[model samples]
Every structure is written in C-alpha cells, then in structure tokens.
Target: MDERLTIASAKANLEKGSLSAEALVGSCLETIKQGDKDVHAFLELSQTAIEEARAIDARRNAGEQLGPLAGIPVAMKDNMLVQGWESTAGALILEGHKGSYNATVTQRLKDAGAILIGRTNMDDAAMGSSTETSHWGPTKNPWDMTKVPGGSSGGSAAAVAAGFVPVSLGSDTGGSIRQPASLCGVVGLKPTYGRVSRYGLIALASSLDQIGPFAHTVEDAALMLQVIEGKDPRDATSVDLTQTTIPELIEKDVRGLKLGLPKEYFLEGMDPAVKKTVLEAVDRLVAAGAQIEEISLPHAEYALAAYYIIQPAEASSNLGRFDGLRYGYHSSGQNLKETYERTRGEGFGREVKRRIMLGSYTLSAGYYDAYYRKALKVRSLIKKDFDDALKIVDAIVTPTSPSVAWGLGEKFNDPLTMYLSDIYTITANLATIPAMSIPCGFVNDLPVGLQIMGKAFDEYTLFRIGATYQSLTDWYLRSPDTFST
Candidate 1:
C-alpha cells in the first residue's frame, strides 16, 4: 500500500480496482498506530473506519456510483462535530463530549463517500499559536520531535505531513491552519469567510474563523475544498456560492498572471532563510511567465494588534456557553456564581482563561470604544488595504510564517512572541479573503511555505498559482524521514 497516496490518485486507483478502500484505510490506520505515538497528531481514532471503508468497497463492487472522495481516508480537527464521535476542542472542559450531529463539512464528506478516520489535537479552546497548550499534550512536528507543530491546527497539518491521511480539515481563526501547514510542510487553505459553512464547528472567533483543508498537494487541497464548499441553511454566515470545478480551475496555466509581493509583509525581524526561500518560489513563478510586482498593504503592520483584540472579544462572548451546567465538565459549588467560577477555573486551560480575561476586560463598558471598537475599525482598514492591492494584482504572495518550526516550549512563556508567529497570516483572515500556504523550500532543514492571498471568493486564482508552482517543484511531495518508509 502506498502511504503517500493523495485524494485524486486514491480515487483513480480505487476506480481501477488497483486499490481497495479497505486496504487504503487499513494502511492509514496502521500508519497512525505505528507513528502517532511519537507524533501525537490524533486525539482519538475512529473505531468504525475500517467498517466504513469496507462498505464503500462493497458498494463499488456492486457497480454503484461513488462520490469524489469515495474510499479516501480523511481526518478532521477535533473542533468539528461528528455525530457519535468525541468532539473536544482540546479543552478539558469539553472532555468526553460527543457530537450529537454532524458538522456540515462532516456530513458533506460522508455524502462524498470519504472515510472519517479520527480527530486531531489542537490548542485548548484554540487560543494559542503552538500546540503546546493542548490539554492532552502537544503534537510534535513529524520532522523533528523536539520542534513544535504550529497550532491550533497543528495536529491536522502534521497528520497530512506524516502521511497518516491524504487530507484533513482544520479551522483557522487567526492563522491556525496556514501557520501550522507552513511549519509542517504541507498545503493548507483558508477559504473566504462565507465560502464554507461553520454551523457545526465549535466557535473560536466566529467572524474570523474559517474551516479549510490540509493536504500534501495543491490539487488534493482543491479536491477536498470542492467536496466541502457551499452554503448551508444552518449557517447564516455561509454564502450561497455557485460551485465551480476547482480541480480543473487549478490546472490552468500561470502565464500572464500578475503576482504581488507586499512590501509590508517583509518584516525586519524575519528569518533570513525564510525570506530567501519564499523569494525563490516567486522566481519559479516568474520563470513560468508570471509577472511579479511590489505592492503595499500599509495597514498590514497593525493587523496582528487588531486581530488580537477582535478575536478574543468574540471568543469571550462565544465561550460563555461552556459553563458547568451544560453538557461538559461540571464542578459543583455552594452557589451558582461559584459553580460557574469553579467549573471554568478547573475545566479551562491557562491560555483559555487568560484570553477570556483579556477579552472581558477589553469589552468592558469603559474600554469597549477604546479597544474593541477601535480594533474593528482597524480591521476595516486592513480589509481595504487588501481590497485595494488586489485590484491591480491577481494575488499577493508572502512568507506563511516569519520562521520555521520552533522548539516545543520555546514560545510558551511569552505570549506576545508566540502571537507574532502568525503576523503574516492574520491579515488574510481579517480581510475575509482566501489564503493558502504551500511548501516552497526549506530553511535549516525545516520547511518554508509561500503564502498566496486572493480576492474574496477567488480561491481559484490562489489554487492556480499554487498548482503551477507545485508542478515546477517537488517540495510538496517530500515527507518527514521519521514517517517515511
């Protein structure tokens, strides 16, 4: 069994009878069993995975038509609800909680004949930039166990990088998906805010959160997005989008495309190797007949500050429902207030508590206009920055992260430094535009990602650029030696 199989290749192999769904799922399960102990990417395994794969194989044997992802094994971030599966968002507060119903994406994948494999680990309550804050434990980078896999979608990215699954789903509130994918050396896409439904996802920052895919190749990521993108009645924020052929759209040539290199994105403190590697990727596109031009998003410098304020303010409001009286962990007290205090104090992790306080403080009566309102205004300006810059260029390119993967505990003591790791990615979320991270090259043996940001709902352009770059380089095809056969 080929452990490195992608969704597109797996589907073709399954159709040709050269690969059985059972064998494919079994290979992934076996790989998880053998390597997951060291990587800790998965929080829980789906016991029924093999059974589901066999059913798909049986249906195919009977000559029934299958969906695009038929028989393909995929892992979902723990935040996504999957009926009958534990959906803890890496918080002890929701420990042992099972989804009563499927998230829209989960149901959609099911309908597409994809086999749900398991749930991956994440930062507790999706508050941290590194997986170190996970209540269960941090998910180590597959490339180097000592290094941290970027979070809160670290586990999802690492799963694809380690070849445990061809694709996985992750929610990006503020670079949660793209930053980790950059660190893990895989492909991660955060679609336009309303492009996909968020009905079943455990809310982190509702306005900023967007669910997307992690895959080894741009085409695989596009394939997964194609299966999941669309409006759902359950989610009011979801847009009623006309589905396009993403796979075919991504195959278009990059010639005549105008790519932008935002001057503001090249920060002073960025690692020299990362900058060089990203520019090399741009050169490859230039060689393919694409044009590069320097552009400016002046407000980009303030994006991280604004995002920190807005995200937490929304997070505090959204997490109010996780009190002990609900379905999750409970801590009884002499009074109702004390009960709420004890339940949250004991159930929530340190980082979660800190953010809740920060958010609450910022949203307080006197501080609302001073902080939250100002941040919202800054967000608008940042969006305008992207809107203006994108009018002249097809897409904006930059480094996904300022640096490669860091040691597990390196940034744990300093929250400000940890937040800076997402400086490049948060602006896209703030702008509500589609962004992607594709492996471009390496820095000191660790992977570097070339980021592409596109206009709202213009994911096709980003994918086309990514696919073209991927065609000219084999960076996406490389896997960690620890997991490689």
Candidate 2:
C-alpha cells in the first residue's frame, strides 16, 4: 500500500474489495508506530480502531451499505471531545479528563463510518501559533524534525503529513488549522463560522473557533467537509444547510473566475522565496484562464491586533469553567479562593497564562472600552474589507504564512514573532468567512501554502479553485522524504 494514500484513493480501493478496512487501519497504525516517535503527532491511540475496522470488514463482506467515509482512519484533535477518550486540549489543567459525551463533529464522523484512530496534540487551549507550547512538547514537522509543524492544530497536520491518517479534524481560531496545514504541506479548511457545529470543541474564542478538516488533497477535504457540515441542534451557531450540498469539487471549471490578490499580504517581511512561489502560483492560475487583480484590504494591518485582544478575551471567559472544581487538575489550598488561585496558577502553561491575563485585563472594567470594545469595532472593519472585496472578486488569495516552518525553539522565546505567524490567516476568522490552504510550492524542501478565501458559506468556490490549481501542479503530491517509506 502507498504510504501517502488519500481519502479518495483509499475509499475507492476499500469499495472495490481491493482493500479491506482492517488492512488499511493496520497499515496506518504501522505508519504511526514507525514515525510518531519523531513527530509526536498522536496523544493516544484508540483501542476501538481495530475493533471498528473488523466490524466494517465484516459488514462489507456481508454486503451492508457503508457510509461515505466507511472504514477510513481519521484523527481528531485533542480539543474535540471523543466519548471515553481523554481530551486534554494540550493543557495540564484538564489532564486525565475523559469526555462523557462525543462532540457533535465526533458523532458525525463516527456515523459516517470513519474509524477514530487517535487524538492529536495541540497548543494549550489552542492559544499558540506553534505546537511548541503544547504541555506534551512540540509536534515536530515531518519534513524536518527540528522545525515546528504549525499549531495549535499542528499534531493533526503532522499526522496527515506523516501518513498516520489520510484525514483529520482540527479547530481553527485565528489560523490554527490553515497555518499548520501550510507548514505541514497539507490541505486544511476553516469553514464559515456557522458551517460546522462547535458543540464538542473546547472553546478558545467562541466567535472565532471553527472545526474543519485536514487532508492530503482538496477533494478529500471536500469529502470530509461534506460529511460533517450540516445543522446540529446541539450547536446554536450551526446553520441549516440541509437543502444545499456542495458539488463534487474535483476538477471543477475555474476558467473566468476572478481571484483577488490582497496587496497587504505580500508585504516586505515575507520570505523572498515564499513570495516568489506564491506569485508563480498566481501566474499559473492566470495562465489557466483565471483573472487576477491586485486588491486593497486596507484594514488588514489591524487584523492581528484586533484578533489578539478578542481571542484572549473570549478564551479567558470560556476557560473559567476548569478552575479545579468539577473536573481536571486540582491544587489544595486552605480556602476556596486560595485553591482556585493555586490550581489555575500551577495548571496553565506560560502562553495560556499570558493570554488569560491579557484577556482578563482587557475585559476588566477600566480597560474594557479601550481594548476589548475597540478590538470588536476593528474586527468589523476587517470583515467589511473582505465583504467589499468578495463582492467584486470570486475569492481572495495569499500566502498562508510569512515563511515556512522554522526551527522548533527559534521563536518560542519571542512571543511577538510567534503571534505574527497568524498575520495572514486571522482576517478570515474575524470576517467569519471560509478559507483553505493548499500546497503551492516548496522552499528548501519545506512546503508553502496558497490560501484561498471565499464569501460566507461559499466553500464550494474555494474548493473549485483549490482543486483546479492542484490539478495543474504536483506540490500536494510531494511528501516528506523521511516519512515516505
């Protein structure tokens, strides 16, 4: 079996009897066993995976109708709740916490016959841009062990990149999914704010967090999204998309589509090689008949500042429930107030604490109007910029990140540099729009992602453009040399 088998190829082989669910699962488990020591992608392997595979194999032999992702091994980010599985969200505060209920997304995947392979690592409470902040230690990029696989969804991206799983679910809040996908050389999607349910996902920023998929190809990403995308009563924010189904996006016509190139994204600080490769990709789209026009997103410069304030504010409020009472870590103190203080102080990592404090201060009485309120107003302006631009163009394009994956420890001591990593990706979350990252090219053997943004609920267009662009190039086909056994 090919190590880098995609969801589409795996499904075809499984349906045709050329591949058995058990065999596919075994192969993936073997890949994890062989490579996860270096990548540290998985937090814990699911014991039910083999049992589920055996049942699926039995059903196939008995001629039972299977679901869309039948027998496919899929990884879930630690932030999402999987019943009976420990979900730490890469934070020690929730260490040994077992989920009693499945997140809506987890149930949807299971209903589709996807085998839950394991939970992948993430930044503590999804606060950091690099996986290095994870309490379990960083998830190394498969392409280069010393480099980080972007985060807080880094483990999921690295898992897919390392052939541990063909598809995985990750939550994106301020570029968590897309940034890591770019760094790891995979296809990652952050759906429109209400497109997918957020019921089981641990909240980072309630308004910004969205659960999405990571896959090796655009079609696989589309397929994964198709199964998980629909209204759920459990999530108040989920929209009713029952009447609308995304069309088969593979090789869709993109000839006459207008793609806007955001001038703000291609600024002075980006890696020269990354800028050249992204421009070259745009040229390929132009040669393929898509029209490209330089567009101005005037408020994009303030996106990062607004995002940091809003995200941390929301995170501070949401993470308040884990203060050593009901579940998670506990630190004893003489009084209730002291116990609360001690537990939170000892349980949270440095980045998590920093954000919590920042959020607390911003939301406090004296600073609320000056910081939090101002950020919200700026967020609206940032969103207006995209809304105005999308009216004229079918989609927006840019480099997913300023540079490729850097050495793991390089930016850990410099929090400001780490925050800048989400500079190109945060606007989409603020605007509540759908965005995707696909491999555009490589710089020094590391992958660079081409980010595509679409109007609200217009993921179909992003898929069409991504698939068309992928068809014209083979960058997504390239895998890490060390993990390509």
Candidate 3:
C-alpha cells in the first residue's frame, strides 16, 4: 500500500507473498478516491482494476508464471485506446468515444499483467504544453496546487507524483512527458523514435509523437519501457532493432562516459535558479567519474520554430478524420460542409482549434513551401546537429524546461510564451533520439529536471546516466508535501 513503493520493490514483495496484488491495487484506488479531487489527475477510474488484480493474485498463488509488471497498477493517458474504455485524448469532440480495439501499448501492458487503473487527463488533442487546456480542467501540480503540471501528459505525471500509481504511460510530441516529469519531480522517458510502436495511440504528430513512461525512479521507468517496447506488425514505423535490457544496463558503471553540455541550452533568459541547480547536478555527475565537455548544437535555437510548424501540420492532418461522419461527437447542419465546419468548431477547444487553424494555414497552397517545407529542412538540420554532436559524446545534457512549475492560468492567454515552455524538449523529438528527464534539484521549492538525450536506439546510455545521477542524489525520493504522508 505504500505509494512510494517502486515497481522493482513491489514486484519483489509480491513474488515472495509479502504483498498481495489486491492490497496494492486497493491502496492505489483508495488513494485516488481520497486525493484525486484536488489534483484532477484521472479522467476516469477503472471499475475492474481490483478485480483484475485479484485474478493476478489467484494466478500467483497457483504457481503460475508472471510477467515483469505483474499485478502493478498503471494509469494510461486518455489518448491511448483501451478496449471498451473511454479514450478522449482530453478533447470534447471524443468525449463519449470508446475504443473498439486496444492500442498496442495497452494490450502489451495487459499481457505483462499490468492493471490499467484509469485514464489520466491531458491537453485537448495533445495540443498544449499545460494541462490547463484539458477539456476537463487542469491537473494541478502535486507539489503546489496553484501551479500548473506540465502537459499534455500532465495528468499522468501528476498521477505518479501524487502517489496514485507507481507508473503511468504518456506520449511526448514535444516534451509532454519530460516537462511534466520535471515539474512533478518524477522520472520520464521518451524512447528512441520507432523503438516503440505508435499503433493505437491517438496521433498528435505522427512522426514526432512517442509513448513513454513516468515513474518515481529511473529504474522503474526503464522497467516500464521494457514492458511496452517492441516492434509491432501493426505499426510500420516500428523498427526491428535488438532491445537492450535497460534495467540491468543502468547498473553498469558510468565512469569513462562523456556527456555533452550543449552551449545553446544554457541560455541567458532561463530561470537563474534552475540553471544553478542543473549545473550543480552536472557537477555531481562529474564527481561520479563522468567526463563533461561543452558542445554546440547550433540548430537548437531553431528547434522550437520548426517544431511548431511541423507538429501542427501533422496534427491537423491526423485530426481531420474526426469529422462528424466518424465515431465521435457530431453537429447537425443542412449540408456536409456546414456539418464539418460546425462539428470541428463546436467540438475542439480553443487551443486545439488554434493549432488546427495554424496548421491549415501552413499547409495551404502558397504557404506550404514557405512554412511546412522550410520547417522540414530545418528539422533535418536540427537532427544533423544532434547526430554530429552525439558522435563526440555518449549523450547530450540539458534542462528539461526553462523554469519550474508556474502558477495555473499565468500564461494561458499568451500562446507565444506557452510554446516557449517546450523549447528544451522539442529537439529530441525532432532528432528522433531517446531522451529522459530526472529530478535534479529544487528551485523555489519546486523541482527542476536535467534532461539527457542519447543517440537513436541508445536508450541504455540515457538510463545509465540517469541511474548514476539518481544514485548521487535523493531528489527522486522526495515526494511532494501533499503526498509525502
């Protein structure tokens, strides 16, 4: 029942009869019942979670073999399809839409004996950096209720931060997972693009979006990633690459490893406290025997601009299928065109509509060459920057976000500033590399994250660096005051 119990510890206890799956599941559900009202993390709680856990217990008692995450309760983002479960992606247009088939990740979790406890809130259609844009209202930062949890994966991050679940699944298009994890003081991992299948996930930006995990420890996140990562036949983009045993790999020595501190990431305008803490964290890594060198990713400055252009362009295209003629919310009109217009106008939230409009404009006849195509070329340059840099170091290090958690609604009206929140994270997605965020230290009583991005398919290196850093500090173990009891 301990909210701080990690997946490794819980799995050990469960296997030895020291913990029952039912007790663990019940405790998580009870915690959600008692605390979710304030955090607003979950969109819906699964009615059958306890029942499923009990079945796992029965199987364990019968000497049946179990999966890696056996009996663990995991909260999934609303964007992942769970058969017969409402998967709205935090959009009103899909409010009542239930998944007819499970997303590949959802089924993978189930097969691994993970109990999907509920659907967590997110930005409407995964279009925003703050969960405040969610149709169901914002998920409060567990560390400070008045502050925003970074999003659109904020709900999943808050769920773990608030002790509602040991781990949760979230998709990062531009930093949804890492930014929220940094704000919530948890470990979030975005695996190498194509290393994990995207089949069944509600697409935000097909090429940029990736499913990852949020957990209390780097090892826990690695374990979750191991359970869900693989080449799926349903997703053509998924690669058939050899998978590394990340949990075991993280225990390897980090000495002799070279990590890059990108000159572009240490900007003049970032929060001074965050910069101080993150640099201090880098010092700890140096003390742990890792060598550090200053590096440059010159295209980093343009990552944000290119990301906005590319992500929305793809999002607008993917979201086009949600017209009233399909399996979601609809509006009646005299004609098909009017129905399409009204359905989208009345269904999507303000931010979603804004992105769709921006996307439509960029992809239009004249602007396509000027905007979207130019963004694509810039994206290639950004990827080259990372590729050229990674050839020198094992991984790239940077701040996960510019600042710590901000007050809810502070920047809701300023779309430009909101977009800036993801400046540090979008490049990983753009580069198609593996990245992770681990709690470094606190700034103004809120957590800051040190982001480590590795070469494509080199998640093992990122995990190794994260696990090494975590061992050098207790930041990951410190729970928010609200959930520390």
lDDT of 2 by residue, 1-485 (tens): 23467988888899999999999999899889989999999999998898999999999899999888999999999999999999999999999999989999999899999999999999988989889888988899999999999999999999999888999999999899999999999999999999999998999999999999999888899889988998999989999974344546355568999999989888778999999999999999988899998899999889989998999999999989988988889999999999999999999999999989999999999999999999999998999999999999999999999999999899998888999999999999999999999999999999999999999998888998998888888888887888776
Give a tens-digit lDDT track for model 1, residues 1-485.
22466887788899999999999999999999999999999999999999999999999999998898999999999999999998889999998788999999999999999999999999998888888899999999998999999999999999999989999999999999999999999999999999999999999999999999999888888888988998899999999887554586566479999999999888687999899999999999999999999999999889989998999899999999998776789999999999999999999998898889999999999999999999999999999999999999999999999999999899999989999999999999999999999999998889999999999998999989999898888888787888777
lDDT (10s digit) by residue, model 3, range 1-485: 23475788789889889999999999999999999999999999999999999999999999999998899999999999999999899998997899999999999999999999999999999988889989989999999999999998999999999988999999999999999999999999998999889999999999999999999988999888888888899999998878655586676458999999999889766999899999999989888889999999998889989998999899899999999776788998999999999999999999898888899999999999999999999999999999999999999889999999999999999999999999999999999999999999999899999999999999998888999887778888888887886
Give the runs in model 3 whose Cα sits over 4 Å from its true position.
1-3
Query: Which portions of model 1 miss their true places by more than 4 Å?
Result: 1-3, 243-245
User: How high a TM-score does candidate 1 get?
Assistant: 0.98
Q: What TM-score would candidate 3 get against the native?
A: 0.98
What is candidate 1's local distance difference test score? 0.92
lDDT of 3 at 339: 96
Would you estimate the TM-scores of all the predictions?
Answer: 0.98, 0.98, 0.98
True-structure Cα RMSD, model 1: 1.3
Task: Kindly give the stretch of ten consecutive residues in candidate 3 with the minimal lDDT sum.
Answer: 244-253
Q: In each prediction, how many residue pairs overlap at the backbone (N, C-alpha, C within less than 3 A)?
A: 0, 0, 0
Which residue segments of model 2 deviate by more than 4 Å?
1-3, 247-251
Tally clashes: model 2: 0
